[model samples]
Target: MSKLRVAVIGCGAISKHRHIPEYAANPHVELVAFCDPVQERAKHYAGQYGAKAYTDYETLLREVKPDAVSVCTPNALHAPVSIAAAKAGAHVLVEKPMAATEEEALAMIEAAKENGVYLMVGHNQRLMPHHMKAKQILNAGALGKVLTFRTSFGHPGPESWSVDGRDSWFFRKDEAIMGAMGDLGVHKSDLIRWLLDDEVADVAGFIGTLDKAGTDVDDNAACVLRMKSGIIGTLVASWTYYQGGDNGTVLWCENGIMKIDTHPDDQIIVELRNGSIERHKVGAIATNEKQTASGVIDAFVESIVTKTPPSISGEEGMRSLKVILAAFESQATGQVVRL
Candidate 1:
């Protein structure tokens, strides 16, 4: 079989760190083109990969005609770019917080359906090794009816992660739309939804810019979530962890308490009501610098090659983004927002 041709849009931090390298490493993929508003960025990546580069995405799509494309652009650009790619006859893998609004996300989904192309979202947290184990244990009835849970994701801020550092588009309200809630919170929402296999029924939360001055977007957010299964939980996303970072979850079940990604040494820990303790070392979560091979690029290529649906479909991404958007509304109204 011939290799699948892939192109990457937006040669920003995410593309530089994750998508580009992963795609290059995939045996079934041939990195055909790179696109960025800044021609230099695109040219740099394209030169390194021995591919073509273009400043305009439309030109790249038309000229390259890749089998698949990865939309690594900003949140606001996700819908239009993904829709265009789908219309151009290429499968799409879009970054998280799928689009700026529910309407846009729905439009992307519709475009993919109409074009008969695969549309997957880059919700890599769902592919974490520990998270995968947690889902397995929960599905096996080991958790015994999870009652409540708390999940949090926080770091110093995106400034360090972005290519432009402090002036990155991440802090700009017009470009990003939402800050920590959209950046970190959505990941937790997606993870929780997948782990529990339930939808978030409602959300009430507080979102604000408590730290990191000179930015209009919120640096912190906290939400109270009610799951469809009658389970309640708290989801917190913050950029105020100046000292370090914490990304983990804890589920209180009838039989035991399951701790995921919390401990320093172990990836998963379970403490039973009967005083039994269990610990498992799955692996560390991916960081920008020490990124372990995320299964994303490989999975996308495999799905296209085998003609199967990706695990994290556009519909699933839309569901997760809805929860985050509802949280924003809940904050604005100072009332619970039902999803």
Candidate 2:
């Protein structure tokens, strides 16, 4: 079989850290192209990979004619690039928050469907080893009836990691569309729903630009969510954790409490009513300071090779994106926003 010819659009931090390396490592993939508005960035990756580089994605799509493309651009560019890729008969693996709005998400989905191409979103949290283990335990009824939960993801903001530092598009409202909620909260929203196999019925939250300066987007957000199964929980995402990053989730269940990603060595800790505590060192999750094999690139390639839909389909992406959108709405209206 011919190897899957893959191209990466937007050679930014995500492409540099995750997509490019992972794609290069995949045996079934050939990194054929790299696209970015910055000529130097595109040329650097292309030179390293022995691939073609282009400054515009439209031209890259036309010239390279890749089998798939990873849309690693800013949040606002996700929809257009994805839609154009699908329309050009290429599969799309878009970054989280899928698009700037529900309408754009739907449009991207439609374009992919119309073109008969698979559309996957990069919500790598679900593919984390510990997170997958947590899902299995929950599915097997090990945690019993989950009552409530709390999930948080915070770091020192994108300025520390983004290629542009403090001036990265992450701080721009027009490019990023949102702040930490879109950046980190959306991942938790998707993770919770996948772990519990439930939908968010309603959400209320407060979001603000508390610490970050010269940015219009919120840097901190705390939200209350109620799942369709009556499971209530709290989700927090922030870019103001000056000390260190925290990506943890605690589940309060009827039989026991499950703690995930809360410890440095032991990734999962389960405490039962009978006072038995279990610790499992599954693995470390990907962090801003550390990069791990996310499994998203592999899964995306597997989906194309096997002609199967990705686990994080565009529809699923839209569903997850809705939670963040609702939270934003709730913050603006000061009322619970129904999904």
Give lDDT per model, in order: 0.92, 0.95
What would the TM-scores of all predictions be?
Answer: 0.98, 0.99
Total clashes for model 1: 0
Candidate 2 worst ten-residue window by lDDT: 134-143
TM-score of 1: 0.98
216-273 in candidate 2: lDDT tens per residue? 9999999999999999999999999999799999999999999999888999999999
Candidate 1, residues 127-156, lDDT tens digits: the string is 889999889888888669999999999999
Best by TM-score: 2
Q: What TM-score, to 2 decimals, does candidate 2 have? A: 0.99
Lowest-scoring 10 consecutive residues by lDDT in candidate 1?
Answer: 287-296
Q: In model 2, which residue pairs have backbone atoms overlapping below 3 Å?
A: none
Candidate 1, residue 58: Cα displacement in angstroms equals 0.7
